[model samples]
Target chain A: MLEAIILTVITAATPLLLAATGELVVEKSGVLNLGVEGMMVMGAVAGFAVTVSTGSPLLGIVGGAVAGVLTSLIFAFVTLTLVANQVASGLALTLFGLGLSGLMGESFVGQPGIKLQSLDIPGLTTLPFVGKILFGQDILVYLSFAAVFGVAWFLNRTRAGLILRAVGDNHASAHALGYSVIGVRYVAVMFGGAMAGLGGAYLSVAYTPLWVENMTAGRGWIALALVVFASWMPWRAAIGAYLFGAVTVLQFHAQALGIGFPSQFLAMLPYLATVIVLVAISGNRRATLFNTPSSLGKSFVPDR
Target chain B: MMRLELVKRAEKSRLMSVLSPVFAVALTVVFAGIVFAAQGHNPLSGIWYFFLEPVTSLWGVEQLITKATPLIIIALGLSVCYLSNNWNIGAEGQLTIGAIVGSIPPILFPDFVNPLVLPLMLLMAMAGGALFALIPAKLKTSFGTNEILTSLMLVYCSNLFLDWMVRGPWRSPQGYNFPITIDFHEWAVLNAVDVGGIYLNLSAPIALVLVVILAVVMRSTLKGFEIRVLGQSPRAGSFAGFSNRRMTAFAFALSGALAGLAGMMVVMSEIGKLQPVISPGYGFTAIIVAFLGRLNPVGILIAGLVIASSYLGGEAIQTSLQMSSKLATVIQGVLLFFVLAADTLILYKVRLVTGREGEGARA
Candidate 1:
């Protein structure tokens, strides 16, 4: 039972992990894209629709990423190109994506979704609970772990990573140093969108195996909080996602076990947990105590 | 190019002001046409049915108001918060709480059909929403927590609480195990006014009156000036001896009260019984209405009407064209994109980049 719960946590956290890491990258570039939810929903709809039509889970993942990127382009154009307020533009992106995805996925509801086939490694599959927990998962689940490590390494070790970090930290300063802050941000935003989309597709293709209206169900918001809970660190974000996932899964398990608490109240437990974590981590300083991109949520407009 | 331009241009004329939202609609139609074509539909007919059918029918117009009433009220309150530079993203939660709290009056006092009961319900809704909002306000003022996150996170709590109430304590004994409350009595219902050929609810007038009152308060009052001052520069506000704590609390409370009013109106007019899904994303949609209205109460009223049309039209298109009603949502979202982009032109100028000149401009 404990092992099953552990497996559920890992499976549940994977999508959030994918999204939060991407948002971390976007925030690092001094842009706050609130459209993460919208992008994810678009991915969910697009991935589900395409996967249903094509019968390929891998194509669905790609479709989801592409859909997210396309939806994010609206945000990029508004905030980056037009110099609209990042927060407001992001809100618009979300509204647009939510509406668009709902429209597109209306017919796709109640249909069976193509699930990503789990990898079956001979040696790895032969091992104990650890092997089953780690190696015997679907492609996206493993990729989510790879993404966290990849983002961490990229943010810390590489020169390109430094440029992206600098763009996020202080766009004006980065521009003064001859780097294209807007260009870097545009790229980062698109990447963030792709990751967010992939996360949503994970829900439709791997986790739920069906499309539902607003199926992301504020997981995007949870991913947003995870960025803060992790204190904007890549590795911490992964852990935070799992932590949230564990809490969410526990709520379900509790209800299934017929625990004393009202199931409705219990259903709200994960969101409440997010608030508590947010309050605990966020302080008056308006800066993360850990390594946060200093210029997160600010727009970078290049002049001509 | 090296010189400073008038960073502040005069506000658009009244004609242009009205035209802007219309223009946004036109832009939406154009983009929506493209979207429909992408989805393999005739663009012109699709766009026409989207707007014209909803307006032509009496029933369609009624649905529009039914859909729009909560949006306008909620957006009216949100304008004040946005203007005060306080982003209260949890109006959805406030609305949910408002419905939960307000329902108590009708549910508990089922035998009492006094007019005052309705008023009390409204008052409780305002208080509930205000009280819920105060959590984030107090947190922001004391712990310096982000009100955006706190308020937004609270929405989930409120939703769950509402769900619990409907499924548990608040569930009607005679409801036959359904996840809802007993139907509200006729006295509890918000009476619809018969206006010439069409009928409209009292909520419309209430929303319009509140919009005017808010506009007057925002434009003509000292408190309004203080809110504007505080939003633009907290330091400047403090330097002028204005209280940040007081203003922050006021902004949040006021916003919460409006959201609560929206809740009362919703329960009174549309959904007579409390359910888990009482609000069909009205709280969140109101944020869009608020911004699209440029955070002006009057602007939000107009924006509310326009957005409300999309909801009505979305349903119309779904049934008529066999297109998914979700397309209406997509259209509204697309409309928001155009409106935001158009708003940017009003606030800032976009310049093209050409090689090293862009680099020099940055420096």
Candidate 2:
């Protein structure tokens, strides 16, 4: 029972971790993409549609990433090129993605989805508790770990990562250094979109194995808060994602135990926890300021 | 030789600012026409139906106003927040709570029918929404938390809370297991007025009056000037002795009250009782309406009408053309994208400059 609970928590956390990790990079690069929900829904639809058409979950995931990248490119064009308000444009992107995905996925409703199978190890399969909790998880969970490692290394160790952080830290100063601020932002935003898409794909292809309109629900929004909850750190974001995942799964588990609370109140647990955690994280000024991207959400337009 | 370039203006153009929305609307028609064509429909007629069919008839126009009423009220409040640079994206949640809280009067006291009853219900709604909105505002002002995140997170909480209430505690005793409430008493309802050949409500006129009053106040009042000043430069606002903290609370409370009022109107006039949802994305859509109207009261009034038509038209097109109603959201999203992109024109101009095209032709 313990292992099963841990496994459910891990599954719940994977998508949030994936999406929040990508957004952490984007925020660190001085851009805030609020369309994670939109990109995610689009990714969900694209992955499901591709899987239904070709019977390959792998291609569906790739399709999901491509769809996300494309959607983010629209945002990048408006915000980065046209220098529109980032918040407004991001909101618009989300509304657009939700609508577009709904229209696209109308035909895919109730269709059985192709699930991404987990790795099957011979001896570990029969091992008491730890086997299924760690080894038996699907490919996406493993990819989430790899994403955290890669993003941590890229943001901290690489010269390129340092440059990206510098741009996010001070766009004006970075522009003065002759680094391509817009170029770097475009890349970062697309990466955020792709990861959000992959997260969405994970939802349809693995988590639920079905396509429902707005399948990502408010997970996209939660991922946005998680970036702040993690204080913009990659590894911390992983911990925060799992922590939230635990809260999400705990509510369902509690209900199963006949805790006597109405299920509706139980369903509200994740969102309430998000608000409380956001308040706590945001309460510390100096610490938040230290990790916050100085140029986060501010538009960057290079002088002609 | 020709290439496209954008040049920032020395000062924002008054003419461009006014024309930008018109230009955006025109651009949306053109784009939407292409979308219609892609969907295998006649582009021209589709555009016409998409934009105009909703308001062509008296009933349709009334429907437009019905849809626009809540949007205008909510956006009216949101304008204050946006102008003061406070991002309160949880108006949807605020509306839900307003409906939830306001329902208590009708549910618990279904027998109360007095002249003051309707007014009291609405007042409770304002209190509910304002109080809910203050959670984020208080956190933002006191703890330095990001209001945008806090507010949005609360939206999810409100959605679930409403779901819980209607599904459990507040469910109508005779609702037959459906997650809904008992029908509101006559005193708790906002009666619709039949003006000539159409059905209209008291909400429209009240919303219109509020918009006008707000417009005048925002233009002439000292507080309005303070809000604008604070929005443009918080430093100058501090120098002017207008506290940012106070402004934050004021802006949030004001908006929340308005959003709550909008919710009450929706419940009283439209739904007639508390249910799982009273406003269908009215809170979120009002954000778009607020921006589309340039965050001005009069502007919001006009933007509200335009957006309201889209909602009606989406339903019309869905049934007529056999397409998904989600097209309305697509239209809204596209219009907003263009509007945001076009709004930059108010501050800048696109110039077609000389390039190497002629040289390439000569070669």
Best by lDDT: 2
* B-chain TM-scores per prediction: 0.91, 0.95
Per-residue CA lDDT of model 1 for B29-128, tens digit only, reads 8987887687688887888777777888887777887778889999887877887788898999888887778778779879988888778888899998
Show model 1 residue runs off by greater than 4 Å.
A284-290, B1-22, B39-41, B351-363
- Determine which window of 10 residues in candidate 1 chain A has minimal summed lDDT: A282-291
Each prediction's fraction of true contacts recovered = 0.75, 0.82
Model 2 Cα lDDT, one tens digit per residue, A1-304: 7777889899999999989998999999999889999998899999999998999999998999999899999999898878899988888898899989998999999999999999767788778887787678787888898999999999999999999999999999998887889889999999999999999999999999899988898899899999998888888999999998999899988999999888878887888888888888877888999999999989876565
> Which digits, one per residue and each the tens of the lDDT, describe model 1 over residues A1-304?
7878888999889889999999999988888898899999999898898899999989999999999999888898877776667777787787778777876787787888878889877799758788878888888988898999999999899999999988888788898888978789989999999999999999999998899988998888889888877777999998899998899898888989998889878888888888778777766355564466778777554443
Between which residue pairs do clashes occur in model 1?
A29-A168, A30-A168
Docking class of 2: medium
- Report, for all candidates in order, the number of backbone clashes: 2, 0
Give the best candidate by DockQ: 2
Best by TM-score: 2
